[model samples]
Target: MAVELIILGVLALTAASLWIPYIVGVNTAPDGSIPADAPDGFIIPPDPNVHRPWVRRAYRAHLNLLEQSVPFAILVLLVDRVDGFSALTLWASIAFLILRIAHAVGYITGTARFPGRPLIFTGGWICCLLMAWAFFAA
Candidate 1:
């Protein structure tokens, strides 16, 4: 249940991140370019005057992380349900969440450079590896 909660929490953060793109889009314009429905928490900015396209794209990237990571977490959860949580499960889930958060913030903020991006991306992949380890170990 604790693992489940952490996953839920991660997902909630992911959901919050969704707002960045929606707000960005609304601010920018009704660009049909973006895929997927805009989530409710994030507002579609009423006035186009405040639009910033680059920022919108950056926000979309964060939204993209949320979009991708949640499914992976669900897959992990399903595996956990069947096999049970191991040390690998706990550590991997933690790492996955952290990397996802880092990935979202680093990419959107653009503060972290190549190594930083690699670190977070690798961390996420490592988490998956941990899951695989658990599957094999089980």
Candidate 2:
């Protein structure tokens, strides 16, 4: 239940989420094909026909998770700093981070279809809820 770890994990996932399109060349290639090279400086071919939709979806999902969790992370850190510690909040935040990363990886990598991604997504949301509850309860 380390708040530092939670923060670090959150930052890790956040960076990965933001970097995916550029790193993976999301919009550069034609449908289901990798581009020979990505375009320069934030401009690239648009994704055609939902090509590589999972990659796009994964990026957005991770970004959304980060957006949703940042406030909770801050609140947890603030409370932890003021109080001795917030074990519940810290654990929940860590859980959220772990689940988010797993969810993104699973979705992007084409892991088992249907239920697996949903479960991971659900796990992340539950962690977020737990973190929020701990923040308020504190």
Candidate 3:
């Protein structure tokens, strides 16, 4: 139960669950989020533009989280497997979860603005790099 592993689990679960909001937004959109002629049972990428503001933000937030989580998860797991853990990994894990949560909330709520959102994203990306670095720095 290392800190990084716990944080990785939480991030993975959050990413896994993000589809619900985006899908709900897609299906409930007033503008008909999907093309009516699209085939059933096939995965269709949801268009955020068709949604209302918050819903559009939700879709974008979910996608952004997924994009960030992949590299974070991979780096954390690789570190755990190859180098055990360290203060760097621990702090990175904690900071990353916080940044990601803030980024997701801010983006979804439309509060993300100016340099704020990008800074948060860059912080999380730095955390991922830190995790990768921990594998060697340990």
Give the lowest summed-lDDT range of ten residues in model 1. 41-50
Q: Least lDDT summed over 10 consecutive residues: which range in candidate 2?
A: 40-49
Clashing pairs in 1: 27-51
Against the reference, the lDDT scores of all candidates come to 0.63, 0.60, 0.81
What are the TM-scores, per candidate, against the unseen true structure?
0.65, 0.62, 0.84
TM value for model 1:
0.65
Q: How would you order the candidates by TM-score, starting with the best?
A: 3, 1, 2
Best lDDT among the predictions, by candidate number: 3
lDDT of 2 by residue, 33-107 (tens): 644464432233335443456655655565655665676566566656556346675666677767766766665
Give lDDT tens digits, candidate 3, residues 1-138.
Answer: 787899889998988887777677666766555567756432244443445677767777889999999988988888888865988789999999999999988988789886999999999999988887887675
The TM-score of candidate 3 is 0.84
Q: Give the lDDT of residue 84 in candidate 3.
A: 59
Residue pairs with colliding backbones in model 3 are none
